[model samples]
Target: MCNTVKVSPRKLDPEIRTALVDIAARLLAEHGAQALSTRKIAAEAGTSTMAVYTYFGSMSGLVRAMVHEGFARLERQFARVRQTDDPVADMLVLGHAYRHNAKANSHLYAVMFGGQSLAGFSLTEEDRQYGRYTLLTVVGCVTRCIEAGRFRTGDPLLIAHQMWIATHGLVNLELGGYLIDPVDADRCYDTLLSSLIVGVGDDTKASAASMRASRRRRRREVEAEPESVAHRS
Candidate 1:
């Protein structure tokens, strides 16, 4: 007869619970949703299978945890973006951070957005509220833009939602390997962001042109550096 060990959530440290979720997220990313199982997650986490049940109650519970984790990480990344007097520029910075976060955590991003990734698990209202709150960060930035007379006078939430859809589509495509050239994808993202800002009645063309000029100047400066000096530094 095989013996099974039961683990109680009360006995497990919070770090252990976080570890289990992290392991599960990596598994989901590397192997896809169908490959997720309590036994596999337990082995990877170096804990008993009961640890899953103890911490999350069931697979659905685990999925919910993943969703929450994804949003929490996204929130942290957005929070790190510094606010500036130029609200449009600040919003663009936040957009870049959003893409960076999604790319860094593609598996978690999938679990959060991919409808079929969770299989039998459905996101509860609370899980969705967590996601909404993350978007609200962007909405706040957009509101700032409007207040600064950068964006057109309108509902900030609607404008933010449109921007989110555009940015999310780009990130999803890149993560899905649809964009093979990262440089081209990045250029496209910048163009898309510039266009969105312009559509909102901002003078993003000058900003975009200035950015290109700056990049060119930086490249020239680097190229002008003596090979010996470059090697030494």
Candidate 2:
């Protein structure tokens, strides 16, 4: 008769937990988002599957963690551009930075922008606000150029979309190696951006639009007073 007892599970360190999550993120950045899973991530990190669950709720939660990580990396990349005091120059720098990041992290970029696994993951209100606000940072630069009589003002958001699509298209094409010509991809992107800057940076009517918006806000305020008084009655 031998005394046999079951051995308890190995204890996981906090450092190991962090490493597991980081490995999952790197996997997402190297391969595609689909390649990420609790089993695989834990296997890579040399941790038990239970440890993955203890740290993150599910695979979806892990993907969200990766998404959050990607945004931080993107913001950090854009933060490195030395724009000094010129908005036009700042935006040009940011546009280039966008391309650079997408190129460097193609897999992560696909996860962020492509309609794949991420399609199932709903973006939270914070995500929506972050995307909208970050886009505005560049749009505001364009608006500043317009206000300073540098660029023509139509709609900053619309113009920002143009820039966004332009960079996205180029990066997407380059990522898939779909460029028909043998020319350097980076050079082509630079040329495209330069053309857009010249094309859209000639309007200077933003100040007029701002005045109109201010007046509209004042009118709305005035209109609200009567409505509130009527409601009180």
Using lDDT, give the best candidate's number. Answer: 1
Clash totals for all candidate models: 0, 5
Candidate 1 segments whose C-alpha is farther than 4 A from its true place: 1-10, 115-119, 180-183, 209-233
* TM-scores for every predicted model: 0.82, 0.70
Ten residues in a row with the worst lDDT in model 1? Answer: 224-233
lDDT of 1: 0.74
Task: Assess each prediction's global lDDT (C-alpha) against the native.
Answer: 0.74, 0.60
Superposed by TM-score, candidate 2 places the C-alpha of residue 135 at a distance from the truth, in angstroms, of 1.2
Evaluated with TM-score, which candidate comes out highest? 1
State how far residue 5 of model 2 sits from its true place (Å). Answer: 30
Tens digits of per-residue lDDT, candidate 2, 1-233, equal 11122221255454554465467766766666666777776666655677666665666666565555556557766655544445565666677677766665554566565323552667677755645656766777778767776677689889998988888788888888899787898578656766777778543343334333433433233222333222210
lDDT of each residue in 1-233, candidate 1, tens digit only: 01223345568666667677777887887887766899888876666888899889988888888888888978877776666666676677777777877876676788886533474887667778888999898899889988988777999999999999999999988887888754598688778888888888787665575345434433333223334421210
**TM-score of model 1 relative to the true fold?**
0.82
Worst 10 residues of 2 by lDDT: 1-10
